[model samples]
Target chain A: MSEKIVITGGTGFVGTHLILELLEQSDAELFCLVRAKNTSAEQRLHQQLAEVIQGSDYAPELINQVKKRCHAIEADLQGDITSLATFIPSGVSQFWHCAASLNYEERFAAEIYDINVEGTRKALALARALNVDCLNYVSTAYVAGRNTGVILESPMAEVQSSNVYESSKVEAEQLIYAQQDMKYRIFRPSIVIGHSRTYHAINFSGMYGFLRRLIQFKGMMARVQRGYLERESIRMNVDPDVPINLVPVDKVAKQAVAIARSDSSNTIFHLTNRTVPTVGEALEVLFSTVGLPPPKIVQDTTQYAWIDEKFNEK
Target chain B: MPNEIFVIGTGRCGSTLISNILNHHPDVLSLSEFFTFVTDLGTLIPQAFPAIQINGAQFWQIVSGIYAKQNIMLAHDIAMKEVLYPFKTDVRFNASTGVPAILQTTLPHLTPKYDALFDQIHTVITARGMATAEAHYHALFGWLAAHFGKSIWVERSGGSLRVIERLYQHFPNAKFLHIVRDGRDCALSMQRHNGFKMVLLVFQITEILGIDPYESDDRSWQDDLPDELISFLPESFSGKDFLAYDVPPSLYGHYWSGEIMAGLDVLDRIPAAQQLTLQYESIPNRHPQYH
Candidate 1:
């Protein structure tokens, strides 16, 4: 029998892409836990994978081999984990827990607690229950929360952010570290952007949504340019020299799956760009590409409010 | 008090201009779509009603429980008085706390039946002193009028035309201003506006209502619409129905016209005096007529 690997949140952006990458390396039986409502996960997975493989010039036979190796099981992380006992049957060789609520504006602490912390707890419990050989978890580098500067590869001891999503993830990391018995690897990725080439997939992060909004605003302004359009750029407490580390989704998945298959004992890897683009450079690139004049970057924290406000308005 | 007016419309019409013009009013509190309210409704309401079981109750109970909380009432008052009543402050407070505060304060007083639980939840939320999110104009209008002594409140919410009836149910005294643009221009604007999601949403809604959304102009509506929307359509409608369907005539003109007409019919059920209609083209030329 082929080795079994269970992936929770496989219907999400990262998981969808990760499954495709994993298929290229292993002929393992890949089972993806998807929401019951997502009856089309199989179709979506096939479609997304087909696009990626086609771009790489992989033969149709190879693509078929990848598809035949994958399967999706309807499951909700918010529900009881014991319900999955039947699916995994006694033991699974590996597990990936990538499910999370990434909404920054999530106000309910309970929900953040439920999905991020509680969901992690359930996944951990399931891994133990299944006696999986190894467990790999995907977390965010922003789990560093309000802390600036070098965010090292370790569990965050303290979290400082008004964003419940970040706080909850920090809390979840604490829970993961607290478990001494479970052998696990954690991948902390920064903001995952579109595929390196296409920039495709439903993106709702970092500069994508903001740029989309700005473009839409530009379109609106084009329709009626009568208003006094005041455009100003400012810098802030965030080091403009500090690189904005954005990992492409394809790279994140490829690196993560490759690392999981390796025998390295390193429990955590910060899957981030070695050299990040500074806030100034990011803004310059974004503004020019979006057809907005380069914003005047004032190096003051007070001016940060204006840039922050623009994002909030979107 | 500042005259805050919201011009709600279906996506891609003229809501941006309506909001911009209203912002120009020296005494008006105008805002674009504050999507946080809908997106975070699950979390915000429960914060206001900690004792209430979110999944256990009926939908109305959940809504009533949120409305009955005391902080919600206070937040509503504060938002109207501080943000909406005076036009001087250009800073928009985050809706995160204001929404729950409004629900915390108002829900209890409005419904009194949940007063006990409301008081309990109110104590917890106020103790934290977090800023509540402002309710969308639909929910905030009545509270604004009752507390701030305003007779008319205008709210501009894009894609709100789909729920004009819900707004009416919430504030019977509230009036709607439906602003539409030339369907062709709107559709073309949508294409340029990264409105694939909006186009898909419109298509799906139309398909579900058993309305054929094809036009004679273009055969690429399926490509133009997002996959999310295509998935939402009735299974009976084939991708071909979406593809071969006319674009310029249907999506850009007649189909949108039909949707607008259907929305107007819903508004027509309200007293004729309570609803007003405008075209995007007319907005730049004419001053708004207030009763």
Candidate 2:
């Protein structure tokens, strides 16, 4: 049989894209690990594959082969993971672990570790049990934490994360390193945006948060626009100049699969945009999208302090 | 310690705006979301020596816990699973945390020396023997005032008016500033905010479990509450019909009316001088800045 490969988080945004890229690029039989929350694994797998093909501009022949070769193994990485051993047999050639809990809140620090760290550990364990040849781990560039300046493509050590999610991913990387016996390649991608050229988003996060806020802020100002209610100024605390490295999801998948396919072992690669957009630029687009004025990003709480007060009134 | 002021409102009433104006005075210390923080951390109260008496180390523990649990998680989706690591040297104490968000947003100069200020506050709180959560409140206010050279501190937290009775019981001498907003507008706003949704869910869960949510000693609410409900607490539970009772979006009107009545009910027990009502409509919109 052609080289058999198993992957976790196969139904997520990045995972689905990776599956399609792998299907077209390689002649490999793929066993995808999917989570079944309320639906059966087969149905979720179908939906995940269907969404990709529907969104992509790939040929019908390749897309058809993409659906046929990719098999689904239903499992929850955060749940009783022992059940994972049932569907797949031993000696899988390659294992790509791409699952993560992307929540950044300090309150969710614990859950982030549970899913990102523990889940990675479990995936590694399953890889070992199956005696996999190579393990490809997908991580984030944010594992650099709050550090500024250029981050080298190397193992991050003695770093402090501003939030729990970053810290948890850092811990996951450490956990992987601790298992020195395994041959693994880590792919660290910066903030994954939609398709580079199409701009079609399968999942909305990061930049989406600002866009959604614009819409919500508009709702607050909607009545005022109609002259039914008086307008109120909202005080926000965002620093407009912060730079965000937004990487296209398509590019991330293509590069990640290429790196995984390479002979390099225990190497780290940063898949990021060459020119990143600043927070100021992102906000401009966001405001225009929701038909609102460019937000008065007020850092002076004393002069514009009423902004927070009025904003929170809702 | 100087006198304490409490601003109770259903939110969307611009109490924050009032606090913003008041905070311009060097003598006035605005404790944004102060009571809300206490209420969120009230679970730790039972562990206090006398149901609320926490020492300096314990006080600091609560402070860091607030950063980890409350401040970090205010976004509604934040959940603290197993990583409750103590306050680190590098982590920022900024907008993500409840009270600090106000300071970080308005007064950038106020923070840089935040850690030193917190240490000083911890020393004073720990030095005193707090017998009740009210006692801790008194110490907190005093520490804040003395540290900032402010003689008066006003407590401002949106939606705090829902549990005004706790404030009345704890700080009887405290002045209450009631801000009222148009219920319809507020109701429409509530349906969109994750914070408001979480507040309503907690209230609903407490009602279902038959426990007083505001009371610190009612620990059984956590035990009696379903796992599904508990799971939702860590994340924003969007499903309306999942709970024992379905909370329709329209109920926001009833919620607003109920809170206004509750605030009014609590106002009756206080002296006329101690209670003041500020209608949101009274404030004129002079700013044409909003589009």
Candidate 3:
């Protein structure tokens, strides 16, 4: 039988990339679960797909191909669960659960759980209802939380998460692994950024968020205090040594699709970049990106704040 | 004791210093840069309580709804916590932009517990049902004046003089204080200021991406900004290697000239009794607000 794939969050950055990669690699029929309220699901997916492929290696051609082959299954992840079964077609060979709430703010705890945890449960429920062959769960490597040392691609005992979103994903992972009958796979990607080769990233979260804010800040200070740039060095509290695993969108999609295509059932794959960049290096790139003065890394803050810049005139 | 006054002038002038002097006065409550260039102006405030009394809860939410700092940060895709609530180990107090900058510099002592301060102000405002950010400011100023037995309230922030027309719409009977600085000096100062540079870059980057940050819905420019601009944005970037890619001083000069003319026009519209103009050279002569 031909490979019949059903995916959620297919209109998102990673989802779009995964769709394009799958279209190039496989002859499977793809169903993308997109939340379409005002516009049609296909219309929303097309617009998102167009945005994702802009300035990439395959521009119009690949997008057009996916547009023709891909089907937009209308379903809201945070919406009614029973309605999901009605939206998604029956007999889905594999259900790819990629949709998630990435908000890490303290205020978004309820919404985060609603989408990340309950949404995953509903997706898994839909998979079980359809009696799908396997459910591929897209997770984040940050689920490793604040723990140090190298992490192997293996089933981990439920541990504390770095943030609320991470914790929600951990809950979702537990739900999947706890399943007694169904075969499931978990793919955890670390800090997804722009494309590796082209640097074409559709979403502007994570590193982009940090960099964009930093530049705005540097510029603001320079304007508020004309001599802001004249300062010898700027400083942040981020650790100097820990490596931040940043994988490109395309790389994550490529590796993820490769693993999803395998026959192995309950395997966990870490879709991470080989050469991880340090937090110091990341901050360096950020300050440098806007041509602003770099801050000297200081582990001690109280003495410096109270003593060095007495009047906060630094 | 709600004697409203505003210090209007082209940015990069001595407006901050003047605001400082006004702030120190026991009879004056100074609010620096309440309204200026921002993506979200809390537009919902103006029409919110039109000719009606808003309850405390309803009015407080409106005032706290759109933090100008939060808006600017969101516009730049930055998290407010990065600057507003710097981590425990963060030595330097880096409150990045907008009204937050005023608070960061003027009240640096609040840096360690700025969030606590914000929460307190939020609680106080919500308790009384402040209608808008303006209303919240007025309320804060009222409290300040009441605490210090001051009757006059003055707001000063650089470049805010450009938005005098909007201010006039809101505060028609409010007094206007104009501090005129040399246009050339203002331009040079602006060219070096990071905020001015950012505005220049935002304009250019928007032009390159064909999206206006002010009016357009196109945010693709954020991702498409030239690599040269982003070259040294890293924290470990060499301090000595920092080279400013600021727009020409002439552009800033043009901005200053345009703002001065516009600000002057707004001042002219206000009754002569409520308008005061002071030259930069006449600073030693002292001003009415000072005494």
iRMS values for every prediction: 13.1, 12.0, 11.6
Q: What clash count goes with each model?
A: 37, 8, 24
For model 2, residues A141-214, the per-residue Cα lDDT tens digits are 98998787889888898788877888888888888777865798888999888788777666645666445444
My TM-score estimates for the predictions, one after another, are 0.51, 0.52, 0.56
Q: What docking class should model 2 receive?
A: incorrect
- The models' CA-based lDDT, in order, is 0.56, 0.66, 0.66
Which model is ahead, 1 or 3, in terms of DockQ? 3
Docking class of 1: incorrect
Candidate 3 lDDT tens digits, B151-187: 8878765577756776776677788888888888888
Model 1, residue B160: C-alpha shift (Å): 22
Clashing pairs in 2: A107-B79, A107-B80, A108-B79, A110-B81, A110-B82, A235-A307, A301-B106, A313-B12
Q: Which ranges in model 1 have alpha carbons more than 4 Å from their true place? A: A38-41, A51-62, A89-91, A216-239, A301-314, B1-291
Predicted candidate 1 versus true structure: per-residue lDDT over A25-126, tens digit per residue: 787878777665534767765665676566543455666765787776666778887568677655478889998876655435577689888999998988
Candidate 3 chain A TM is: 0.90
Candidate No. with top DockQ: 3
Writing each residue's lDDT as its tens digit, candidate 3 over A168-284 gives 988899899989657888999988998888898776577876666555445433433334444545655557788888999998998888887878868899998889889888867
TM-score chain B for all models.
0.46, 0.70, 0.67
For the predicted complex of model 2, DockQ is 0.02
